[model samples]
Target: MSATSKKILVVNRKSPYGGLRSREAIDTLLVASAYGLQVSALYLDDGVFQLIQSQQADQINSKNIARMISAFEMYDLKEVYVDASSMGKRGIQQQDFVIPVEILTTEQIKTLLHQQDQILSF
Candidate 1:
């Protein structure tokens, strides 16, 4: 990584398809990666739904964020994460998520936040 490569954490806290925040966050992730920053996404609250599988956005006439997420690897935007507490509260199993996510405990989330050089919350 270059010295200019910042460790950024993009936090998503809104519901998927409810508004443009989720889409904006994903856009930021891709742009940051293209700029050579070390980017990761931390999904919490209703944002976890953004990772759920088999979303039919066409029916709602919305761009499919789920499909966008599956392409994160191609953009070199890895290290996707989720809050364990959020998942449990929503009754979402790890396998239920469309993309692979590193489910983190509260303590781990704290540590991650501390380690990041920049935080962009959506």
Candidate 2:
């Protein structure tokens, strides 16, 4: 920790295990949290599917990314957010997510980005 808490924002725009993007985003957040930084995770575009309940990665032989996401609480990293429009486009209601999350507009997301000491997008 520094003299002041550092705010780190991680943006995920891809589905988990679709490639490396979502994995890297989550790993970054975990590392930042381990260092005791204030961290937030934002899901946009296809990334919203990453938080969907009952994902079946086994069919694709992919690792269960949802389990990694569930570890956020253990790390005390709780500022999870999703894009409201994205969710609507995907037909994902609030109850569809495995975890409750703050839904924000694009403008709200921009405001959050501006508040962060660092921003990493994946």
- The number of clashing residue pairs in each candidate reads 0, 0
C-alpha lDDT of residue 106 in model 2 = 92
Backbone clash tally for model 1?
A: 0
Tens digits of per-residue lDDT, candidate 1, 2-82, equal 645768999999988999999999999988888887889999999999999878899999988999888898997779999
TM-score of each: 0.94, 0.93
lDDT of each: 0.92, 0.88
Off by over 4 Å in 1: 1-3
Error of 2 at 47 (Å): 0.7
User: What C-alpha lDDT does candidate 1 achieve relative to the native structure?
Assistant: 0.92
Off by over 4 Å in 2: 1-4
Q: How big is the RMSD of model 2?
A: 1.6
Residues 1-122 of candidate 2: C-alpha lDDT, one tens digit per residue: 57238888899999877798888888998988888888899999999999987889899998778878988889888899999999999998999887769999999998999998888889
